[model samples]
Target: MASGKPIDEKVRSEIITKIRDEGMTVTEASNRYDVGKTAIYTWMRDGVVNSTSSLILENNRLKKENEQLYNLLGRATVELKKSKR
Candidate 1:
């Protein structure tokens, strides 16, 4: 079946809102309205859930924590080995 025209942002948002607001799955919406999974995904990527700040902050925090843990572990291991000898 040929879907007549491309679904616009408003219509896509409505579908997404139904899924989000009513707890409907994309597959369920797709089946119910003759939409496709790809279409739903395309709509999802059209600037929804896009975040920059949290991801950058999270990466920086994880990097600092990892470096601190690595240094602490290395120092503790060296001290333990020195004490044993």
Candidate 2:
């Protein structure tokens, strides 16, 4: 039977976490949390958008770090060449 009540954000987050981080399947989470499979699927879709945003941010940060490392290496190479000359 449906609870006929809204699930709270905290509970929703826990359910999502279990599915994403704990390797729980959608069916398992739906059963364990007493939520509908459709709701869990919707949550997973929404989470993918958020995860994509986070991945973009992380990729930008890594690009900057890589650029800085390349610059540092170039400077070190120049200094090494100067010392050799």
Candidate 3:
């Protein structure tokens, strides 16, 4: 027998919402909805998650920390050079 008919936009939106809200893994979602993992990944990459998404917030935080660390290192290098002169 053939696979069931393709799901509609409503169902697709619900699935995407579930994936984002529940932090469901692509593999789990694929198995549950009979959707391909690649399709799920494509949805995620296509802006399914909002700007205030936790992952994006955490990424921004990490980038800020990285810049701070680099600035500190540069200052330390400058101090070392002055001390050596």
Candidate 4:
């Protein structure tokens, strides 16, 4: 609970969750939990970067899947046209 001291991982997670999910302000959490504002800000920034990375990977995967589906549809359409002719 002190600055420069190692905080427990569960407690750190709870503090971050309070700031994010419960809408607790950085100043408030710092004061309430006796943590430094800088530490909390760092945690938030790290979380954002990690989340963005995950989103980018997921988006890329979905794009590939969509392209594959389109290719399959195009092939099916071509086969249908040939059968009709």
Question: Which one wins on lDDT?
Answer: 4
lDDT of 3: 0.74
The candidate with the higher TM-score, 1 or 3, is: 1
Best by TM-score: 2
lDDT of candidate 4 over 1-85, digit per residue (tens): 5568876766777888788889999999999999888888887777634554576689999999999999999999999999999
Cα displacement (angstroms), candidate 2, residue 37, comes to 0.5
Query: Cα miss at 65, model 1 (Å)?
Result: 32
Per-residue lDDT tens digits for candidate 1, residues 7-82, read: 6655766777788789999888888878887777766666333343345578899999999999999999999999
TM-score of each: 0.46, 0.54, 0.45, 0.53
Please say which candidate is ahead in lDDT: 2 or 3. Answer: 2
How far is each candidate from the true structure, as Cα RMSD in Å? 7.9, 4.1, 7.6, 4.8
Candidates sorted on lDDT, descending: 4, 2, 1, 3
What does the lDDT come to for candidate 4?
0.82
Please identify which of the two predictions, 2 or 4, would achieve the higher lDDT against the true structure. 4
- Candidate 2 lDDT at 55 equals 68
Candidate 3 lDDT at 18 equals 81
Per-residue lDDT over 1-85 for candidate 3, one digit per residue giving the tens place of the 0 to 100 score: 2145665655566678788788877788778888777776766677544533555789999999999999999999999999999
